[model samples]
Target: MDRALLNALFDEAVAKAQPELAVTRFLPAQPKGRTLVIGAGKASAQMAAALEKAWPGPIEGLVVTRYGYGQACERIEIVEAAHPVPDAAGLAAAKRIVDMVAGLSADDLVIALISGGGSSLLPAPADGLSFEDEQEINRQLLASGAPIGVMNLVRNQFSTIKGGRLAQAAYPAKVVTLVVSDVPGDDPALVASGPTLPLKGTRADARRFVELYRLDLPAAAIKLLASDENLAPQPDEAVFARNTSATIASAALSLEAAAALARQRGVESAILSDAIEGEAREVARVHAALAKEVAVRNRPFNKPVILLSGGETTVTLRGKGRGGRNGEFLLSLAIELDGVAGVTALAADTDGIDGSEDNAGAFVDGTSASRMRAAGIDPLAYLANNDAYTAFEAIGDLFVTGPTGTNVNDFRAILIR
Candidate 1:
């Protein structure tokens, strides 16, 4: 398969999943009174822009996006902040959002645009808890190798706005939430920690995660989690009676788009699964094994077929690596493929940023392993140091797309010819 075409297919998947394509279709009807738009996430700004374009009436709102993920919006205000980590900007934005939604009458409408990466972009420390305390816990949770559900369970308990509190704050106003899912199973509560969704989890679960991971958190955070007061609102709460939510985009949709493109190109494609979750390197090894089987024995399918998958993957971050999970997966797959011919692969985060790095991800082909060795770049060493970014950069295979203004988790493709 042509490498450029393979990369192009990956790009197609991302483009298909963009908010501009999916958001307009899921928009709610215009409210009778003023429309107040509010949201947070990597894709939220783009989602807001889409809303403004589709809505015929005047829209007033505020949304927070990752530092580089903000898009142009005519009516709604866009706030840029940090992602994968909470910052003062996020805290201020979160506070402003809560204030904006307060004291609204029944005629007012609240449009919430939520997506992945919002957990960090919309952080608000609970009462009696400091922003520094929340930041510390966020740092620990990210490094704990916990799944998104578990991490969000803990994070929601510490936030003043997450776990349906955003919707609760907009009580009396008809709230319609539009989401772009980036979690396994497309569970609404796990996306961006479910800022506008109901709380299905309990404070007990949050405390359990802290103990399970042996997280060292501030005394105030621990105390809040242990207490029953100020807990997240349940589904039965009256605020939820007027709430409506829709998932506008997700991993499954993007994966199908990629598979469709492959079929159009006269290449067979099989989407293994869109709900996959696990360690990045281990997941890559499994994909590599399947690709080898297809290339050598042709058990899964005939040659010239591409294997595609999408979902969120975690890295334990044992070493001080400079790469994200996508880069790590590519590096591991390369080592496992061991210079096998007629095999090419690409792995990247759909959001156009992997982990905390600038590059979306990396690529690997038949000669990648041997070329790295010849260039004195050891894959194992880089992997051990969690530095796949440098290893792939040395081979000139780092895939950089800047900010795509969309997020649905990771996209991986393995081509066997």
Candidate 2:
């Protein structure tokens, strides 16, 4: 398959998740009192723009997005903030969003456009919790190599806007949440820690995860998690009576769009899973084994088929390398498939920014390792140092798409000819 075909597949996956296409149908009927738009994540700006076009009545509120991911919206205010880490702007936005939803009458309406990266973008510290404490906890979570769900579970305990607190503040008012899921199993609550959705686990559950990941949380954070009054509204709470949530974009639909394109091109497509997780390098090794098996024996799937999978993966940050999980996965995959011919693959985050880098992800093939070696770069050393960005950038294989204004987690395609 040509490289253009791979690009086409990735583009199709992203196009399928566009809020312009997904939000219009999910919009609720015109409200009686006021229509308020509020959200936070990488896709909040695009979603706000889409909401402006779809809602019949006047809709005005605030939404926060990552830097450079902002889209112009006349009615809804678009604010840019730091992502994967909370900055003053994000903390301020979170505070404003919570205040916006407070004291609303039952006649009013709240529309929440939640997506990936919302967890860090909306960092409203609960009672007695400080912004610096939340930021430190976020840093710990991102570096802990824990699953996204685990990270969300622990962080939400310290946030006032997360774990359904936003909706709780919106109380009698009807809250409609349109989510672009970036979490495994497409759990709506897990997306951006479910600002408008109900709280997940109990305080005990949060403490358990903190211990499991061995997160060195601040003493205030630990004390706050122990308090029962701070727990966000549960599923059975009356606060969620009028609150409704829908996952507008997800890895599942995005993968199917790519598979459909592959079928139209006469290439068999197989979807492995949409919720794969764990360490990036380990995941890459498994994918490499699958590619080799298909190339050698075609046991699970026939030849000339593209194996597709989606879901977020974690990276254990032991080395001070500049690379995201997708790039790390590809670098490790390249090493494992060193001499296995007839195999090429691409892995990228749908958000267009993998980790904090500009590139979405990278590509790999059988000769990738040798090519790096020829260029005086040791594949094993790069992989060990967690420097996939440098390695792939040196070889001109990084997939740079800028900000696609969406996040469906990771998309990986392995083509075997």
Candidate 3:
């Protein structure tokens, strides 16, 4: 397939998997009592709008989203906050949400809309810990090169509302959660750090993660974790007895949708894996080998095939880089492909924000390196410096779709013919 057609197909696949469309199909019947909405993520606001349009009863509550991801809703308040890092706005919003759900009777219904960014967007630190303590620890964790699951496990241990504590706050209120999963395995507890589900990890596990990752934590944080006064909610609590949650959308679902689009275009498709995880560059190298194998020998699959995969990938930041995981993966893929014939690939975060960069991700074809060389650029040096965004932008190949209003994780597609 040509470049334009491939791009169109990829974009269509992402659009089709948006939470606004996906959440509607999984929505339950109108509650007999009052409806209370609470959510957090990059897509929380958009998800709230979807609930408003679908629900038949009066709905009121608050949802926190990343800055610039807010959508208008009449009854459901949309609050903007920071992501990949916590801020005062998120801390305040989380407290408000917890308070709102408190004292709710079993007759009331609480519908939680959760997605990728909810971990950072909802920052109710456990007692005796400040938001600054949480923020500093989050920064250290992000720079520590640890996987998302590990990071979230640590996060759950430090928060009051996460790890099923939110459900506890709601007491007997019936809580139904609609989640757009961005983590591998689609574990409901790991998504947004499992605010509405029982936390499976323990304080010991959280401390082990910090030690294994060598995360530099503040003295206050360490003290708080050691104190029984600041311990997170336990998993065997009665408050979790009536809570229920479901993944309405995920990275795997998005990848399958993309593969279907490729097949409809007369191109065969295969999903490499829905739960791929590892170092970004190493994952790119593996994908490069698979794409070349399919393109040349068609061993795994025939020619004119699209290889699709989804899952969160991590990038170890050794250098001062200006790219996200998807960009790093694309850069590594380009170097490994080395102008291989009849293969092109796109790697991008479905949320439209890659790490803290402006672009969603990037695209690379067989001639990508040559085109960069012709433009007096060096892909390897940029890759070393973690500057994939600059390299792709210089070649006019950076994929920039600002805040698609939904997130399910990363989407990767390799087309070979």
Candidate 4:
């Protein structure tokens, strides 16, 4: 397996899903009156920029994205905020977004540029719940290893501007949402907690998750979850008549692009799944098994084949070590492979920031285990401590791409030769 070739394929996948390349074509038609472009997510700034470039008419609005993911937009304001964990900046930005949409006329339009990471990007706590309460909940959800969908369900219940509330606020006006899906199944409701879409999960579901994760919540937060008035608006509500959404980019598109690149290079390619979800290390174990089969038995396919997959994975933190799901997956796979020749892989987040880390992900070849062992790094120890980042960094295998201006989900590619 050529390392350079593997890296090239990953690059193609990331580039193909960029907001600038995928957003403009899905933009809604210009409205007759004022157009307010509100959004939140890692790719929202880029999405806003694309919308501004395509729309000839005057546009005004605001979008909050993770700190350092902001892109320049002349008409729309781009506010930088924290992600994976909510902060005061995100709370304020979310409040401002809700206020900006209030009192719209029937002829007005609201274009929501939603993407992955929006849940944490917009954290407007409900009436009773405070921003600190939302922040604590976010921290718990991330550390609990809950999938993105479940996390969003809990997040929306406590948000003042999520779970269709934005659309409810813009009632009587047209609301069109353009999304870059990063969650499994491409559920728009899970994309940034469905700010402009109807809620699919209920407060009871949120309570169940709180118990499942053993999270200690504030009394105000618990009370808000049980209140019917704070729940997401019903789908049958009259406000939904003018609400609509479209997925501009997604994990499937990026995975297909990577597979096409592999085929062009004379290698057979297979997309295992675009919605696989589980604990990061466990997912890596399954992929390592498949790679072993292809290399040793050639049962799945002949030699020189690449397997591609995309989805969000979770990491149940049992240690204080610093790492992301992508790195943790690679480290575990390297240990499982144990220097098996003719197998190499790369796992990365399309957004270029894996879990709260600086690197997109990491690379692991058959020699990865041996190299780490030689460097006095025990794979099992690091895996147990959730320290994959340091393990990969020591071997100079951390793959870092600052910010890709787009996010679909995790991308994993395995080459069996």
Candidate 5:
């Protein structure tokens, strides 16, 4: 258990999966016509910069990202905005982007760079819906423990630019989208509410998600769903005929990069899955079991194996928790391991922000509990209140990598020796 080695491995993994590096390989050849770039997400600014450097022709556009994620790009205007929750800055930017792409000619090229956090950073309320109304709904959905897919389904219905409408607005223009997927399935349509991919979810799916979560919605939202006028953009629509989208990076890619680093250091690694989801604590328990199995039996995999997984997980906030989902998961996993020898693990969000917390995530080794107790922090009590961040902070185990400028969702790697 070399902590320095673990940290270096995590850093290398993130570097390999960064948008600037991952996006360049997926970029299509420069189109013959004018390239109009419009994007929104935590990584859009960096992705836009990468595009400008790689594209041979002139590229002109505007992209919105989280406040601290901006990069220098002369061709693409970068706007910083609030994230996780929509604000006036994001609302105004979304409107401007929508307007910027509308009424382009057939020869023009529209490249939409989308990634995580775009849902809130590119907030554009649908007709008959106010920004405040949409903001309120976003807050409720986030707190309701709804999965990203369900939340995006509801968001797409209420958004003016989402669900392929952005591409629709640029009708007759060739649209090419390069996405860094943060969703579980890596579905382009689900990422950033499918602003470029064709929207396939029906009003029924949106209604069911709301009902399933028992989320209270405004009357205007309910009315909009009941009416047939504001459905999500469909595949059969003319706008999708010339549109092309590619998932440039994903959580699995990050995990694999981490594994490669581990292997180079004489460590064996296995990717459990890239789409693991569910309650954060429950998912931790499952991972803990697998780790114990590998450590004890050495059956499915030999010792010194690292189990990797990615994808977004949720937390059904029941207490006054001051922790992100990754922290919660690590706390639960530490409890389950209970000082089991030769096991070290890290769980973090690829975007460098985990569930509104400042830290990227937390790390837990076999002695994690011992270290916390030595610092006079009660790990169990903190876990009960979902305050894993405080617990990890006391022991200096919290991983803080301020705004990596790209997002591919959560990355979890467990080392069993």
Candidate 6:
């Protein structure tokens, strides 16, 4: 199997979601009055840059993205902050964005460039919630293994800027949100906790998730959730009546791009799903089962076919090891498919960085586990530690692509030849 072919397929998926290509198509007509842009996510900065190039009218605003994911935009301000965790930088930027949209008139237009990672990138705590408390809440939710839907409900309920508050602030004005979705089913509202879209569920729903996930939230966070504050603006609210949102890029779209490329190159391909979710290792086991079936028995799709899937997976941190969700998934797949010939796979985050490591993901083949063992590293021991980054590193299989400038979620492909 050609590792280069796998890499090319990954590149095609990423190119399909590039901000410059996707954002321009979803951009609304230039407003009659001043256009203000504001957003937050891994792709937001690049999205802003794309907007500036495409929009005819003058645009000025702020967008926050994960550190090192910032893009250079002449008119729009690109603010870099911490991600998968909130920081002082994110809080300040979120505050500024909320303030910026206030006092807008009905004639004005506000465009929100939202994508994955926006939840943590825009951490404007609600009233009486401290920054430290907000940070703790994020850390707890991420480690809790909660699905994105539950996590979004909890996060949006506690945020002053998210959960449609951004749109609420720009109310009376026409707000358009162009999203690069990284969530299951490409739900725009779930993207970045729906900063510009209306809130769904209830505070009680958020509280239920807190308890369900057993989150060790800060006292202030608990109090906020328990309080009967103004419910986040609902879909029926007048403010959202004039607002509009579109998913410009998504896991489904990117997966289709990869599958299309494979078929074009004479390799039969099938997409099992574009919305799978669960613990990283557990998901790997399921995919491995399907791959082994086709590879050995040729029961499902026959040989010389590529299997593709896209979805976000969670990792419950049992041991303090270095890896992103994609790394963890790939490592687990390697172990399950040990010594099986003519099989290769790649699992990566579309935005390039996977978890805490610089590598977007890692490449694994039938002999990946054996390679680790030959290098005196135990595959099971490494996966147990959540140390897939180091495990792949020892065997020179880590895929390092710094910040691909777009995120549609996790991309996984299996080649059975």
lDDT of 3 by residue, 62-123 (tens): 99999999999999999999988988899899999999998888888999999889999998
Give lDDT tens digits, candidate 5, residues 184-230.
97988888887877667788888888898988888888889878867
lDDT of each: 0.88, 0.90, 0.85, 0.89, 0.86, 0.91
Q: Which ranges of candidate 4 are over 4 A from the true structure?
A: none
Model 1: lDDT equals: 0.88
lDDT of candidate model 5 versus the reference: 0.86
RMSD (Å) of each candidate, 1 decimal: 1.3, 1.0, 1.6, 1.2, 1.6, 1.1
User: What are the runs in model 1 whose C-alpha is more than 4 Å off?
Assistant: none
Q: In candidate 2, which residue ranges exceed 4 Å CA deviation? A: none
- Count backbone overlaps in model 2: 0
What is the per-residue lDDT of model 6 for residues 10-98, given as tens digits with 9 covering 90 to 100? 99999999999988888798777879999999999999999999988788999999999998889999999999899889988988998
Candidate 6: residue 335 lDDT (0-100): 96
lDDT by residue (115-150, candidate 1, tens digit) is 999999987988899889989989988888788898
Off by over 4 Å in 5: 373-376
Clashing pairs in 2: none
Task: Rate residue 33 of model 4 by lDDT.
Answer: 89
Model 5, residue 10: what's the lDDT? 71
Which numbered prediction scores highest in lDDT against the true structure? 6
lDDT (0-100) at residue 377 of candidate 4? 93
TM-score of 3: 0.96
lDDT of 4 by residue, 5-85 (tens): 788888898888888888778877788889999999999999999989988888999999999999998889999998888
In Å, residue 292's CA in model 2 sits off its true spot by 0.4
lDDT value for model 3: 0.85
